[model samples]
Target: MASSSAGIVTGLVAAAFVTIGVLAHQASVTAPADLGPAHATVSPAPGAVKAPRDRRHPDALPAGSGTGERVVYSVDDDRVWLVGPGNKVRHTFAVTPGSVDPAPGAYTVTSRSSRITGSDGVLVEHVVRFTSAGGVAVGFSAAVDDAAAKPDPDRPTGGIRESRADGDAMWEFATIGRPVVVVR
Candidate 1:
């Protein structure tokens, strides 16, 4: 009888332990309540902000200048376009100013010359000079050379001229009467 009583006591203790363990497990398994709205906010790093998307300038010439009067001869990362009228790309090229650098302010084309010398004594003309939106003067010159031989039979033979050096940085097209577009 005593042994049976002892066995009963042992079983009760075991059952109590088991119950305690189950209760503990249940408590541990419960989901945590959602905290109220967070008070502290995190922000992105200084350089993390993405650059603003570039919008197409209204005065900027179209990629193809769709008039059949102009053609897109070359494009650089869609930033600068070399366009010419009458399918003669050799004469005119339109550049979107400040596309490479920020423009100071509104500006206009005061005057243009075919050749100008750099401070380094290198002759680099064939540039369009503009007075900045802030009255500061700036120029954009094409760093291309004319083709060795005239490729287009339609264009005038004498006006299209270029330097003979391979990779010549100076290029000029015959713009005697053609309308050129300049954007700020």
Candidate 2:
């Protein structure tokens, strides 16, 4: 009877290990090629309908940011805009982008952390993560100490740094499943 019980326990443990392995494999297959295994499960969707943008101004919210409440990040401008209802601009600010930029498309906010150590080893707060790029988790965060400095070019990171005030606004505005649009 003792030997039979031991065999049953061993079988359960082996089954659990096999299940874990299968799950890990599935996850790897679904992740984007550039994002690696740590990427959020939600892949970036097609680009939003673009509105005509004014090439002259870098500050006025770029055209084609999409209507309704959304967070828009411009890879070229290094700017962020928190848009509200009726396509009104609630807040606009500059940001220090990370080494890797997500492609120009639409993604939903996948997760958030109030305070945590960033991939660059800096203490950060109000981390609003939307997508992954270049084998790293891409998100917006403010340095806990308010530094909001530029990231090291040598490191492959996706942390878009923002001011503390801006981080606060982003934390409040961008919740899970919120639309995040990446423009030029």
Candidate 3:
């Protein structure tokens, strides 16, 4: 009888471990709530309309923006997400894109200027440049006068304008060599 009792105890312990393992696996495979059905849809055909943003969580970091510390800029949404370790979104904000948009791809911060005259002739601060399009240097900046208006369409410009506070955050987060992911 004691032997039978020991066997039953061992069986229960084994079952518990199996159950725990299954649960952990499920959790690891499951997408984060904000990601929504994204990982599976990362590589849609070229020129395919990008997935619609989650209306419920518009500020959620876009899916397929890659993992780890990086900046994600969505051209369609005209928004930026500062992603940190563990794929968490540290901050997100709307931006005003210029006439040229960077092609959807990964890039690293190539340079930054604390204060400079933007291509559009706006006195800007915290200029964080990552890529260029059509000879225009693409970057994020805030106008010294706090202007965040749309850029003039006639001129080719690449400044993705942000608010002063947002520019400060970008300046601090996007150091040189930090990954910047552009998505449609």
Say which candidate scores most in lDDT.
3
User: Which residue pairs collide in model 3, if any?
Assistant: none
Candidate scoring better on TM-score of 1 and 2: 2
Tens digits of lDDT, candidate 1, 60-127: 44332333332121122223233455543333323322212222122223455666552222454565
Q: Write the per-residue lDDT of candidate 2 for residues 1-184, one digit (tens) a residue.
A: 9999999999999999999999999766642322122323222335623334677775788765667788988877788999999888899999998887777767789999999999999999999999877569999999999985778889888899999999999999999998887876
Q: In candidate 2, list every pair of residues with a backbone clash.
A: 51-64
How close to the true structure is residue 132 of candidate 2, measured as C-alpha lDDT?
Answer: 79
- Sort every candidate by lDDT, greatest first: 3, 2, 1
- Provide TM-scores for the models: 0.28, 0.71, 0.73
Candidate number with greatest TM-score: 3
Select the stronger candidate by lDDT from 1 and 2. Answer: 2
lDDT of 3 by residue, 76-140 (tens): 89999999989888999999988888777677899999999988899999999987777778899
For candidate 1, give the lDDT of residue 46.
32
Off by over 4 Å in 3: 1-52
C-alpha root-mean-square deviation, each candidate: 26.8, 7.3, 13.4
TM-score of 1: 0.28
